[model samples]
Target: MTEPAQEPPFLQDPYAPYAAMRSACPVQSKPVDSGGRPGCLVIGYAEAREALADARLSKDTAAFFDGRGSRRRLHPAVSRSMLASDPPRHTRLRKLVTRAFTTGAVAELRPFIARVTDELLERWSPGERFDFVAGLAVPLPVIVICELLGVPESDRADVRRWSAALFSAGEPDVVDSASYSMAGYMTDLITDKRLHPGDSLLDRLIAARSGDERLSEDELVSLAVLLLVAGHETTTHFLGNAVLALLQHPDALGRLRENPDEIPAALDELLRFDPPVSTATFRFSTEALTLGGVEIPAGVPVQVALGAANRDPERFPAPDLLDLDRDATSHVAFGHGIHRCVGAPLARAEGEIALRAVLHRFPGIRLAVPPERLEWRRTRLVRGLASLPVLA
Candidate 1:
């Protein structure tokens, strides 16, 4: 007897099927890699959340390259980056950057963030129309990164391109070229930073010490690159995606517009509705372990689908509906466990202020094009509108 062919793998607009998949197989078994062993898909809210915090699953790539499977890099140029490592190395690397992004530490940067938001809004004038993703979401993070890293504003465009390419999902050859270019550019920047130390995040990290524990040369470079990439990419989508969601649902927008104080909750709802990072940072299986009933063997890669888990009915009522007043927690938009984004508070602060400003600054703001016709990111990693053409 033939097991029925699973529906054509869901495409860009796939929130619905994920719910169905979760309903059918909370823990689903899918082929691993090309022809390797089978891996499991964790779709339940609690199950996904549990796996994120599980110590058994490792982010380190050594096992992936080890005898457990082939040695080919899975994520292109990102293989050696921090997101690919686990344990003491991850622990050490995270520590250096974490201090710079500590909760209250990020709070101190709000005024500057507000100022940047104000300046960016000023560029739009009174009745101009522009691509929100390109004009605002993209640059806002670039500027914030320069400020955080102590890099001069003059070099941000180049840095933005570098970080974008490095994290972007594309063919291996293209990604490899971008990785090489970004690495070369970073090496130059690091040299310059060494020569002229400035009052920037780079300087802080370079000088960071925990009783003589300092970031290694590779650690510094990787962290710096990671900062630029992680600092902006996810937040870029958060703002653009949030506004996109609001514009699509006028009542939700109106509710948020009226309450104004509900922006935080609104942001949370936006994250769940259309999270920036559709999939959680990749984690590799340690041993044959069962998640949500399926047995995922050791040395297999498993991903927690944030987009799916965010909408799991068991965790969120009416998972597909966007509620402006939703008390939206339990969201994995920011990955869980020790890897929970250290810059989350800052990212949240930026999104709330940037998005609310767009609404408050232009109450008449509306999408210039039909939602269906607008473009979206092709990659499954970052779920965001490509160019949200809006009239303000």
Candidate 2:
């Protein structure tokens, strides 16, 4: 089995390693992301797309850790979520969620979203320097998702802290604690929602769980945690990446500024250019499968490089250039097939609103430090700027 070099391939730019892998070995057994688990990396566009849609490639964590003895399971609140389950369970969880996140439901939040964006912009005055992450990207989605989940405004900070620790590349003990704490918090929240059902998404879910035999208590808790985390993390990073991309490509930024109508299309291209979730969560083969002429054994984990596939020359012309007009709808940024991001509509809306507001508020916004001085999150699952200082 081949392993990546000691120095993490994605530390600075993951594309180089991804390009090399796509060209030299599109599908090869390799060490899994950061955790040193056995797996394969699929970088080619076609192969990655096929792998994402392949049913034989299971999302069950139990299948992955079946024979690992002591390393048997993840916290149920995370492992049982729709993202990590196959057909029946995933289908059930997604169906209940679809009722709450329909297009019309998400579209109705446009006014609330705009209000949040305007409120965030009020932080920066003319010529003031502010952190794009802290002032906008991070809090915007956090507040929106928290409100939707019926989380008390006073408790949002604690939720954010718990989430950060849960998703970080930190100590194992700390990660475990965060997971336990979040699981406990979500359980209590659901119990409270049952007694006091408000007109919120969580209330709807609680009703579904109680009224019909729609889901178990565990599934209810897991789904709630999934929505809360997935709702913000991807969008948060996408905003940071999108802003940085716009700053680097002045022509594209200028085009959007001149024609606000193009903001929607520009957001699509930005997602394709620099996806927030660099690689998909994880997929394991249920049986031996052949991909790119390589045979993957049953139970081996697989990670599809969504960012690399989005930039594949075969799939997108002038893959390296940031063309706001490019038709990037087929990009696997939100993933492919049934497992694609359920909150994609919300994320897109937030992206357009956030970028549009930022540009309008500060047409002169520019990076405060040299590009090389910027720090990237060290986790392999995501690609995001830790902080984006901007002079507006």
Candidate 3:
């Protein structure tokens, strides 16, 4: 059977059409833009990875949002961060901060993480119910990021508020205002650090180099912004989503409670079962590329289906089942190839601690409301639950 000319672009549920698109057309067309122009959406895991890591696919959305190949350059420094750029600029930025994401760096953080979780749990009352997201999950990532960057722990709340505003999916003004405020705060922090250099990632990054090569003033400021936003948001959703998964599946929770060793594997499964990132950030084609018989022209937008790819039956049998023991290496939750998430290690550590702590704090915890009443985040780009009430 031949694939249709296009799938509806507003699709939120990606399972059905994605599976069909995999065999018939790895690349399927979808109408985009205010003018209703056409572009390709890569469905298959192998094909999607190729497009994401391919040098020809630029990660910039500035041009797509504005025609004439131009952009205002949001002052928050995120637009200039590694997540949105192509090399050699991206190479330089990623290299400068790579040490912060190493395995050693994550392992060294375990003790501090344990303490963070313990303290949050201590504050909870056993018989009462509370919003775990607000009291625990939200603060966990915020505190960890602040400590990693050597930002004052006291400033985390304000910093996190600013962080959300900067990355919000809204009009240019909302984003622009948030960026300006965050930049001002970061600039002040960097200036203070320069006068009194400390043992923090940001301080070391300021001094990072490659045999005489160093990040410029602009890159330095931008890198700080990226670390702050990414440091909190991704893990924020990860912890929230993991809790939702556990409440939905009691058997999985029992297994983890019995054998905490399964936490790592379970973290991998949570990431695969319901990845925090729903799709890759916008990728613009540098040249015409065809996939599964569909053609995507230059400068057109292409979004990889991360959630769909994670659940692709071709890759994993019983794609909907949450198997903690499954080999999750193939999932595109962190994405594929060179452009994969640089913060995966830190995020993983946070997930392990978050889930283990959830079990410890809320023994026999259950959903306060029915699953049908649960409200998920409406935003299409980032997959997250709005709330998951827990009765401790």
| TM-score for all models, in order of appearance | 0.91, 0.94, 0.89
Which structure among the candidates has the greatest lDDT?
A: 2
Q: What is the lDDT of candidate 3?
A: 0.76
The reply for model 2, stretches above 4 Å from the true place, is 1-9, 33-37, 70-73, 209-213
Q: Write model 2 residue lDDT over 1-392, tens digit each, in one string.
A: 23222344466577877777777877767786456777898888899899999999999865466556534235788766789999877887888887656779889988999999999899789689888998999999999999888999887888888777666774556666777788889999888888888988888787773433477888889888889888898898999999999999999888888898899877779998999988898888889989988889887889898999898888998888999878988899999989999899999999999988988889988888766666677653778877888898
Q: Is candidate 2 or candidate 3 better by lDDT?
A: 2
lDDT of each: 0.77, 0.83, 0.76
Error of 3 at 379 (Å): 3.8
lDDT of 3 at 374: 57
Candidate 3 local lDDT, 5-93, one digit each (tens):
33233333446656666767667676544455666677676677777778878875654555644444477376656788887777777
Q: Rank the candidates by TM-score, best first.
A: 2, 1, 3
Which number leads on TM-score?
2
Stretches off by above 4 angstroms in model 3 are 1-26, 31-38, 60-73, 209-213
Model 1 lDDT tens row, 308-341: 8888888889988888666787788898888888
lDDT of 1 at 79: 61
